[model samples]
Target chain A: MSVTTPTGFRAAGVTAGLKASGRPDVALVVNDGPSHAAAAVFTANRVEAAPVTWSRVAVADGRLDAVILNSGGANACTGPEGFADTHATAEHVAGALGVSSGDVLVCSTGLIGERLDMPVLLGGVDAAVAALSDTGGPDAATAIMTTDTVAKEVLVEGDGWCIGGMAKGAGMLAPSLATMLVVLTTDAALTAPELERALREACRLSFDRLDSDGCMSTNDTVALLSSGAASAQVDEAQFTDALTRACRDLAMQLLADAEGSHHDITIEVVGAATEDDALSVGRAVARNNLFKCAVFGGDPNWGRILAAVGTTDAAFDPRTLDVSINGVQVCRAMGVGDDRSGVDLSGRTVHVLVELHAGSEAATVWTNDLTHDYVHENSAYST
Target chain B: MSVTTPTGFRAAGVTAGLKASGRPDVALVVNDGPSHAAAAVFTANRVEAAPVTWSRVAVADGRLDAVILNSGGANACTGPEGFADTHATAEHVAGALGVSSGDVLVCSTGLIGERLDMPVLLGGVDAAVAALSDTGGPDAATAIMTTDTVAKEVLVEGDGWCIGGMAKGAGMLAPSLATMLVVLTTDAALTAPELERALREACRLSFDRLDSDGCMSTNDTVALLSSGAASAQVDEAQFTDALTRACRDLAMQLLADAEGSHHDITIEVVGAATEDDALSVGRAVARNNLFKCAVFGGDPNWGRILAAVGTTDAAFDPRTLDVSINGVQVCRAMGVGDDRSGVDLSGRTVHVLVELHAGSEAATVWTNDLTHDYVHENSAYST
Candidate 1:
């Protein structure tokens, strides 16, 4: 429930009228500790947002004291004006915190390629600075939101360290890391290089493979900030466990809030020749719009799974592939076998199990069913 | 206008009441005589429909005498029962035509993983045979359609050889080719080997690069049957041109009928390092649902285009990328360098011009916008 409960930092979320809905617009979380180690992963999209640009620069330093997140304006393709707004925000936040502007990270989520309302955003920045408190973690967790049904914040209490984070994504998600924006706070003591390495590993397994509809975004970012408040150095095992749990929990929340999503689907690829192959096959199925539509219809169309898998170069004999939908084996040896009447489509949750008959390692990722709401929400917006 | 206008064939179509919509569901096209040669391509999906399996084997011999197509049932996941249905239909058609069963090609389009309603299909097969006539081309075109607003049949008078074909793909279309069933008839006298070589070359540039939503299907087939009716032995150049034009026109029609399409989009990539680079970059943009949504909303959101193109492996300096939307230069040298005031998205058609500036090869592909109609149509049916 608390963003600070899992780690060594304080966060504050405040509403400053940036959004007409009167939701929180500004969130500031500071790592107040003996360690300033951090790592971050940014969107691979060429059209980067201003905040992503700022975060990329900050993450290069391998350390961060604070992250300033604002919703209601994506600060994306607004040309030079967008960059100026980001710089001005960092300056204002740094002035208030009495810290270097260069050390202050920034991220924004909302409409893409739009100019931020400097008057409103700057006002939110002032209010955020004024409202910052050691116990404002919950508010900060809810501040950076855009069309999300609820604030996505996760807290994990580890044996030797703590990890907490918040995420925002209701649309525009796919590999190459779509519009997902996250800020992870931890109390574990580590250097910038270490944070970068660990964050990439976490993202590779957790975020990078999370595909919704294969549309890459211009403002996808995931940042890690550590305060070293725990003081004790947590070993790599505990650190990864905490990071994994926090990311996993947050990732699911993102899936749950996907635009126009009904059924939260999970595809588990088992018995693959390699983890990459498993992921490749799984991602292929996840991105297939026709398959997702079938899931939305609750048709239990498992043939689409094999059809999607066949398009990949992953090593597997199609005829040797086996597929099960919600515990019912709909296909065997890469071809349709038994009557799918055994499978029940009444359930809201759809699960696809694929066996490659190659090796042991498996991978699973979550996504939501594609519905008219997704198309409506996305198409309704002019950009 | 005529399926047999291409080279050396005759065709027919008939209504057999297999479709609940009371539409035509049986079609047949046959080569006249002269030891006709042929080459064909089948869907890459592993979960092929029963007819796909049958026709792949039939066309594997590099010769085709007749092709039978139905629109009501896919005969996809009926297991052995489905194969039995395909075999029964093929055998019946071959018997009526006085030809070997292996020489008959087949295609089915409808819902996936469902039985072919064997009795109804067989009745339709018999009716199709009875309806066969030298000039029944339009009826044949009408018989092989499902959810299509109009039947897609083309007739082209070539220099030395004429080419005509009918294609059906209202949805489930992408590069690897999903559920796109096409049958071409030509009267040119050519060897099966030469036809094979020309068809592959034509397909790579025409059908292979077309992407709607990037989802491949399990029921795609494109078979070119030669009747050896023409006395002149045409060279490969003329054959390739006519073949490419026919396939390209069909591909365009498919894109125009894309499920839930509001706008027909053309992605033109020029100055790419290689044709592959051009295609990869073009596909990345063409498959982006957000861009499709934006196009539907009539917003010339160039940022989305840049974001999509940037995620590709095509070698290009993202900083040096140039984009022109509707001939209005928006981005230059990887940055916004010109006025975007000239962008007009008020029309139902859009053109996204991308310049990699890497080299001198250009490619154009047609796609449609992602709309609520598309989601509704695709998800509403179990197929």
Candidate 2:
């Protein structure tokens, strides 16, 4: 799957020197003529980035021409200067593309409260505009990354429509839609309203459900743009299905790359009294740092998982709950899992499972193990 | 404030050779009283330790003769073997004290799913009984610790009544009350039913409010026993006041000893629309690892804090929220805290204040910084 496999969109990624490591820092995607219908989701964090503000204003008309993204300086908490920086970037992009400035969207991700060097950002925008081409998907994917080890790109080819997406985020990922900045491009002739509905539904099942580090970012944004360049007419269900699948793939990639993560765990809570209960239990485990650390240690500490589940309001009889670590049934009927013999946990990754035995509904959440690196990364710079 | 300061309660602590470090591992506390009123609370986590199982049952009647506690083996997830181990430990302690095993409460903390060595545990029990004396409080305090830098104890004197408590827990602390195992002694006479009411209330305000690492322990217990040696008649309010003060003091001590903690931060959400809203916002910050890490970095990244606050269900315009870091009012009406100049996060301990400006109600939660040692201690273990 690739993000630009959709019909009318053209994409490009280029370096702007935003990151000292000299990786690509600017990504530009454009709807080269046709329906520029668009919908965007911004971070729930009250501390928004400059780009979030600019994008929110651009979506006022429910139509968009392009998205310009940068990675490195978050351009957040820089006061009025950050706002001016965003406005300048979007205005420059829109002027060059001969579209309304309001039609140009922007996004940013990096260290919070840091200012972006305007000269580098402006030069990067110029390079991005010149480098824009229909098939430059890899470049676009590589541009919007701060600390991500690898770029994320997903493209879906449908009968009537095509969808392509690129996302950048590794840490500060959790529910509340995670800390990602994702852009979805489609060649289907869809309206802004329809795009909003489909995007929200797809996100609910994919991006919104991926809980990695349990911390939300101030610069989270997801934008969906339609190029209206497809030849066939794909139905709504087909489009949404393809969209969801693409998002799921990217979300999984992001989870795998979560910082300081030693384990890629998938917690499946089944037999819950309700789907809500299942999710509640799943989230409780996903957000538990201690439990995550235990997984990092390769310890099948199912007791920690059980404790996390019990802390939730979800209804269940502790004695009735069943737990399995890796495929070993270690807790049953609230008593204990049967297999405690010869348990080995000296592995890089581990899987833990819990069953409520209360009902038939189930849900799975993906997460990473907590490790010493995570603590070192978070604690070392105490100024 | 020390556990030994309480009236009419005898305690003994000794190293049982059960721990590889040769540290104190076993403790005994007895009430020489005219009343047998006792109350207790256990970990809300469904996966409880073996000692937790026995103590939970024994506390149902709210009347206990003695409490036997040990460190080094949590007796959790040992399957049926763990339960049998709990029974044997209780039986051994009972034999030494010449009391029914059911009259003794047991608590153990350390590694999960590890079986207790019966010989070492039994010998420790005998030593605890022989050394049980009111003056042995300090020994008992040292006997029940795992990763704790210092023992936690509190003493409070009220009119005709005294309250004293001791607790042990470094990690697995958060809502549902951090994983603290506490034992309280009182000289006031009360029924088991009354003691339960008071203890629950005290926990709600004290232990339950601290949201440290957000990990609930599998083996948490709080037992309160009355020695019935108060010199004069006392009112319920007087007894509760003293008990509450003691519990709060112990809770603070626990926070002070929180493993891998750089800051003992207090997040106060004021002017919320409701108590639940205030609490949700407060807890949202308490649980935000990025914000915690940012504070650790001394960046005064108030934006991350606001971003965390925005993700909650609490109602407030993002821009209208006011945030303060280290007593420096950083964000006003949803804007940047501007003077990032004076935001002092240099201290190992930090306090953050968030004003929602939605209502008059306020809520506070305590938590610690995200640090490397926490990860090291947790990740190095393999169960």
Task: Tell how far residue B362 is off in model 2, in angstroms.
Answer: 2.9
For every model shown, what is its TM-score relative to the native structure?
Answer: 0.94, 0.91
Task: Identify the candidate with maximal TM-score.
Answer: 1
- Tell me what TM-score chain B of candidate 1 gets against the true chain B: 0.96
lDDT of 1 by residue, B1-383 (tens): 67756545677788778788888888888887775688888777766677888887898887788898888878775667788888988899889889999998888888766676777877877877777777778888888888788888887776666888888888888876735889887888778888888888878888787787788887888988888777767777888888889888888888888777888888999999899999989998998877888777777767778878978889787656888988888777655646665788777678889999889988887678888788787776663
Query: Which tens-of-lDDT digit does each residue in A1-383 have in candidate 2?
Result: 44566767778899988888898999898888488899988777766777888889899789999888898878776667789999999899998889888999888888666678899999999998899887887888888876688888887778767788899888888776788889999888878888888888888888787888888777888888988887678677778888888889889888888876777888888999898999899999998887787777766666677778877888787667788877787777655556655345566445667888888888888888887766556543223
Question: Residue A226 of candidate 2: its Cα lDDT?
Answer: 89
DockQ numbers for every candidate? Answer: 0.53, 0.50
TM-score of 1: 0.94
Using lDDT as the measure, which candidate wins?
2
Q: Candidate 1: lDDT over CA atoms?
A: 0.80
Stretches of model 2 off by over 4 angstroms after superposition: A1-5, A16-23, A46-50, A53-57, A60-62, A75-89, A114-123, A191-194, A335-349, A379-383, B78-102, B118-120, B159-161, B190-194
